[model samples]
Target: MRITTVETFVLSERQLLVRLGTDEGLAGWGDATLEHRPGTVAAAIRELSGYLIGEDPLPVTAHWQRLTRGGFYRGGPVLGSAVAGLDQALWDLRGKWFRAPIHQLLGGPCRDRVRLYTHAGGPPGQTAAPERARAVVESGYTLVKASIAGPVGFLDSAATIARFVEDLEALRQAIGAGADFGIDLHGRVSVRHARRLADAAAHTRPAFFEEPLRPEHSRLIGQLAASTSVPIATGERLFCREEFVPVLEGGVAIVQPDPAHAGGITEVFRIATLAESYDAQLAPHCPLGPVALAACVQLDLAVPNFYAQEHVIDLSSAGSSDLAILRDPETLVARSGYLDRPTGPGLGIEVDEDAVRAAHRPDLLVPAGNPSWNYPDGGFAEW
Candidate 1:
């Protein structure tokens, strides 16, 4: 079917949906939701708009190349993300046309269920250590991840380091080995400070240490990995598989590709495959809306080198509505700690079109940095 029109709708649900119309009336959906950058991403989508009209919607690869390499200068969040959404819509349309889920097209499922993990909230200090850890374990999550500090600058203080380890030690004592624990350095620590946190948490045998240093310094992650037994996980900032090539080869034990940012299913499928070649695991970074999660699940189902997923509890009202729209969304039904792959067509999701259309560009729908986050010394921190 020939592509007729491509429309981008940024909804009040804090998600961006691209609707690609085909001549045969079969349209596909893809989520290109970028937080704190919706307007910019949407504008990029519009700028990459012309080539899609009248082309065959089924030629996703050709279309992707056209939108990506066909340009004067290619590759960045704006151009790359716009093509990601469009590529997803093309894949969705193809899947629906064949009446199969995305996994079947990728060579069928390697396993029945995909494992997942959730973020367990805690205070800046150890004020609620036992309670928070108990809440996570009691809620039946087999694994929960934590960040020791809100913001950690280079060589902040020995007291800061001591407090973080002390709090984590307390949580580990309370939770024990019944559930696995991990930590996100949040790219706030310098190499030296990161080494310190890794040294302290190494004894606890945390699942993995994530983004110990900035991803741009990913070349050193392998060195950091050698310094500690814990695995290294990053790639939330990563946008494509080509970007992740050196990352996996860098000896990072895991590759975390965010479907929303990493070119949706098309590129993520490629990312997962490349990771498989290196014997690295894939734990997709998805802390966004359900459509994006559904897209992640579809990729997770088909990938052979699958790993646990990062999940987030709904923090806002619109986020709740986003999940409600999915046809077969997976919730935290951890059976000894594993989430099953979703079972629905076309990424296993069904969007609430009317709500999506109504809330086009909903308040707080646009992606902008959160300002409330701050370091202990009153400096701004990354959120």
Candidate 2:
């Protein structure tokens, strides 16, 4: 069947959902939320819509190639993310047409379940980070992740480093030993400071050190990884497989390619295979909504080197109604820190058009969702 229309729903300030409708009345859903810039991603989806309107939705490979490189000026968060969502929708369409889950179509299940890790709370500096970590563990999550508490100078003092270690150590003590948790540097620390922080916290035994430095300085991560015992995880910013080469060669233990930003199932699956060659694990970065999480879960089920999946508990809670956009949200829910293999065809979740339509808030602008931060000396800081 040919695609009839392409629709975009700006569901709240952070979620931009895409719906590809077919003339035969079947529709596939994808999420293209690009954090603070949903409008730009939506426009990119519309720009790509003209080419997808009459095309067959089943040829996801051809569509992915064309939509990505078809512009000749491709690859970035906006375009890669736009292609990622559409690719996810097309895969959903393919699975439904074949009467099987997306994982079954991808290479079948390599594991029985997908493990998940939830964010402890807002940021680490928030008043109740340790308490929040305890609450998440109480809610049955065996894994939880939190960010480093405050901003750092180019070269922080020993006391600053001590506080960072103390904060994570406190959370570790609160959660106890049964749980595995990691501290995300969020690429906020400089290379020297990252090494210092990682060295200081190594005794705490984080599940993995995330984005020790920015993707731009990813090669340096290998130095930090080699120096510290904690596993190094990066790659939420790198858009393509080629971009992953240095990190893989640099000896990172975990590669956190975001399916929402790294070209969806088509590219993420390929990235997983590439990581496998280096013996690296994949813990996809999925801080978006349901459709994106469903897409990551499908990939996690199919891949052998899969690690834990990341989810934003607070965002999902705020947009709790967004779950109704799925025909069965239960399939995507976590149980005892693990998600059961999805059984439904096409991404294992169906989008409710009415719920999507009602949640559309094109006018809503939540600046608090993204805050601008600065150093004590008035220089820019990563937020």
Candidate 3:
């Protein structure tokens, strides 16, 4: 079927959804969210649509290549995310055309179920981190992930390091030895601090330490990895396979490519295969809406080295209404921390177009930027 129109909807300050309509009366949905930069990503999608409109949607890979490389100035967050959303829509259309799930089109399932992990933790320095971890584990999640909480200075005092270790230790104790948990440094720590923290918390045996250092310091990851016992996982910021080469060579045990940011299913599948060659596991970084999670689940089912899936849990007492954008929200939920392989066509979960439209907030069409933080001395801090 020929693509007739490419439309983008800014559902909220944090959600950007794309819809691809075809001449054959079929439509596919994808998430093109780039966090606080929804407006920018939406503009990118609009620009890329010039290549997709009136083109055959079945040639998913060829389309991905052109949409990605057609612009000589290619391969940044905006272009990758724009291409990612369209790529997912293309795959979704292909699955519907063939009457199969996206995973089946990618060579069928490698496993029957996909294990999932969710984020948990209170604000920085709160004693509630362990409690949150325990609650999720008690809810039947065998895996949980938490951030270090609060901004960490470049070379903080010994008390800072001790508190970081203590928080992780409390989480480990709360979850017991049966369950596993990951630590997300959020690229807030320096290489020296990452090494120090990894060494101190090695006894807790975290499932992995995620983004301990920023993307720019990826070349130094191997030195940190070699000095510590915890498995290093990154790539939430790196947007392509080429960006991931040094991370794999640096001995990162897990590759956490975000399907929404790293070129969607087509490119993430290729990233998974590349990581497989390095004997690394795939745990896609998905913190966006349902379509993104659905796309990640499809990739998780087909990749042989798939380890786990990172799903976001709104820690607010009010919870999240993000799932209202989906017709069947349960389709994306996990039972006992494991998601059942979906039988539905395309990305598996169906989009509620009316809900998506109703949830669109016009104010979000203008960027407000993410919250910024500063250190005690008034210097800038990563948030």
Candidate 4:
């Protein structure tokens, strides 16, 4: 079938979804949410659609190369994310045409079910982190990741370090030895503080420390990894295989690539294999929407190196707007901390067009970038 039209939708300012329609009437859906810049991503997708319209949609790899390399200036968040969303839609369309799941097209399933880990967001200072951590454990998840709280100084006081240790201690006590906990520093801490933070968490035995330092500081993370036994994990901000090379050499035990932002299934699969070569685990970063999560799950099932997936199981409970644009939401529902492989063709989830259209609010104004944080002296800090 030939591509007829390419369209984009926004449930809010937070998500960009793409739909590809072919002459044969088959429709494929993809999500290209780029944090707070959904409009920019949508515009990028529309610009790239010029190359896709009226072309045969089956040559996914060829199309991916054309979309990415066709532009003289390519491969930033907006362009990469635009290509990623279209790539997912094309793959979804191809899977449906072949009458098989996307993973089967890759090489069939390597695992029976895909394991998942949910986020447990807590109050500032992480004072109530343990309570939230226990709730996820009680809900049948053996693994959960929590964010570091509030603003952190470049050289925080001993009390600051102690408070973080205390929070981790509380979570360890609340969940007992049966569960594993991961910490997302959000790349807000300096190397000195990050080293101290990782050293202090030795007693807690965290599953991994995510983005302890920003992507630019990946080289120093290996030193942090060597200084402490805590497994270092990063790469959510990185968009391609080239960006991941230094991170892998940095001795990170896990690599977190967002399929929606990192060129979709095609690139993330290559990233997974690259990490595997370094003996690193694949724990995809996916805190966006359902279609992005579904795409990650499809990749997770097809690869042997996949360790776990990052997901926000209940959007409303997470204090986020409800963006359940799926006709069969149950297709993505995880049970006992594991998501059974999707059997339907394509990405294996159906989008509720009416619901998405109703939620679309292009006029909504969301300030770009995360909220800025600062120390008492008003110096810049990472959020």
Backbone collision tally, model 2: 0
Clashing residue pairs found in predicted model 1: 12-359, 35-367, 36-367, 36-368, 37-367
Candidate 4 accuracy as TM-score: 0.96
C-alpha RMSD of each candidate structure in angstroms: 3.1, 2.2, 2.1, 2.1
Q: How many residue pairs clash in each candidate?
A: 5, 0, 0, 0
Please write out the lDDT profile of model 4 over residues 252-328, one tens digit for every residue: 99999888889988999999999999999899998788888889989999999999988874732322234367877
Model 2 ranges with Cα > 4 A deviation: 122-128, 314-322, 365-369
Global Cα lDDT for candidate 1: 0.73
Which candidate leads the pack in lDDT? 3
Give all candidates' CA lDDT scores.
0.73, 0.84, 0.87, 0.85
Q: Can you write out model 1's per-residue Cα lDDT over 1-383, one digit (the tens) per residue?
A: 78888887876334677888888977788877676667777778877778888887766777877887887887666666677788888888878878888888889988887776777657665422556666767766666787766566677688877888777777677678877777877777777777787787677777777777776877767677777677888887787877887778777888887777777777888888899898888988877666666677788888988888777745223335446654333442345445566556676666666666766764554455554777666777765
Model 1 weakest lDDT span, ten residues long = 327-336
Collision count of model 1: 5
lDDT of 2 by residue, 1-383 (tens): 89988888887656788888898788888888788787888889989998799999999999999999999999989999999889988998898888899999998999988888888754545412888889888878888998776576778888878777788888889899999888888888888888888778888888988887877887777788778788989999999999999999989999998888899999999999999999999999988888889999999999999989998743223235547677677776677777888899988987778988988887753423677788888988887
Point out the higher-scoring one by TM-score: 2 or 3. Answer: 3
Shift of residue 9 alpha carbon in model 3, Å: 0.7
Candidate 3 C-alpha lDDT tens digits along 187-208: 9999998888888889989999
In angstroms, the error of model 2 at 228 is 1.1
C-alpha RMSD (angstroms) for model 4: 2.1
Which stretches of model 4 miss by more than 4 angstroms?
315-323, 365-369
